[model samples]
Target: MRLNIKITFFFLFITKVCLAQDWMQTPIPGIGNIEFPSDPEIFDQNGVLIYKLENDDAFYLVSIAQTDPSYNAEIEANLEEYYEGQLEGVEEASGGTVTFKQDIGIDGVSAIDARISGVANPELPSLLFKRFVYVNSFNVSAEFRPKKTDELEFTALKDQFFNSLQLDVSALGSSIVVDEVNGEKDAFKKGYEIGYVIGRIAFWVFLVIIAILVFYFIIRLLRPKKKKEPKATASKPVTKQKIECTNCGKSNSTEAKYCSQCGYTLPRD
Candidate 1:
């Protein structure tokens, strides 16, 4: 069961690589109309179309797909579980280490906010965030990354991408597509924004720890240790010796005037 769930999420993740652009309102014909920051790289996979917009510093991608009506019965049976499965699927697909998710709404359409980090892809930036919107007949999903280094600027851009999403069901009756989006940018919830910030901070902190370890090891290898010198031992002092008197052949101390055995006077040296 767990293996099946992971496969499902991996499929969803690789299939969905589709985000924001200009004020230009372009119609998607049978699908609907969408506003883009600029022209995106469009791909047609069978019936589903994926759009990707990116530059040196940021990326935005989105895709919409038709969902089976039969699944709707299951969704109704357990809506929370259904959403949780989707969230877990994405998390597994990205090979993410940490994930933060919340229930969100897009102009009444129910959606999930999925902010993830530590994807297997090291090339992927630390601040990768996305949203998935599920409609009765279709699924609309989008990813947003910012070019600006400033946290505030990145947050602003992220807000622009989510708020600009407009789902048009009228184009194909049950199908979903971008409608039109502009004006008073809706801000991302404070908690969700903080989650993104924390992910980035965590990534940098990990790098710093690695750097400190490397530096410490390098210093240990290069620096030399001092060898201790052996200490010198003290010698004992010499004591006075007794002298023999030539006149009486009596042994006496060098400082004594006479020997106790013969009472002879000791000569002064």
Candidate 2:
């Protein structure tokens, strides 16, 4: 019927309208070593990454390494995101015969000043590739060495790429800056620091207040309630009944005398 069709269309329209109101665009900013940076100031702009790994093995190795603490689980997580972002994007994805090294910052905030080089060729590669991958072409410098080589050491560095203790940045530690110095606590900046401290204090106070209120309500509920006694009502007079003792085979208290068969006393009497 025309009415049903109109009603259906109306419902569909209402659903779409509600959906539009509830719609939210979640932008998953790719995290980790390999990623798609959308900042106009970086890369080829247009957020397009044209690089591809010529070395398939190196890509896999880096992917594994990223999961280790050093890479912040970005290799696996970021590559997927990087590749995903590359797909159906303003950029074309390619990874072959290309190598470069670059310092990567997370969301342009915290930075890691290091080189990332991916090489695939292995007619005879050095022992360095035992821990890191050999990529012929990467974004960062291939020959960049560390100043503090012996600062930390890892025995199982080769076995696990996503090790948190192997001079590897973990997903948790890499991008998160929990213990920060941002207050007048630093003699360098007083005004901003004081404001920050105030804000932090307010946040903690709010949490404590909420916790206290929750406890109060819980205690109020757990407190025992007084039970009401049922009202007594006058009814009928009760009647008594008698029974026999099976062991002695004697009858007692049919509201009567003891059994003549046995010398048992009457229960009711």
lDDT of 1 by residue, 1-269 (tens): 45445544654453342112123343444444455565556665565557778876578887767778788666755667767777677678777744677788766667788777766666666667878776665666788766577988777777776677776545545543332111111122244356557865765575566556555665665679779988888988887788998788877878788876778777787
- Span of ten consecutive residues with least summed lDDT in model 2: 35-44
Which residue runs of candidate 1 sit more than 4 Å off their true CA positions?
1-22, 26-34, 170-269
lDDT of each: 0.63, 0.32
| lDDT, residue 233, candidate 1 | 83
Error of 2 at 179 (Å): 27
| Deviation in Å, model 1, residue 13 alpha carbon | 41
TM-score of each: 0.51, 0.20
Candidate 2: segments with Cα more than 4 A from true spot: 1-188, 228-269
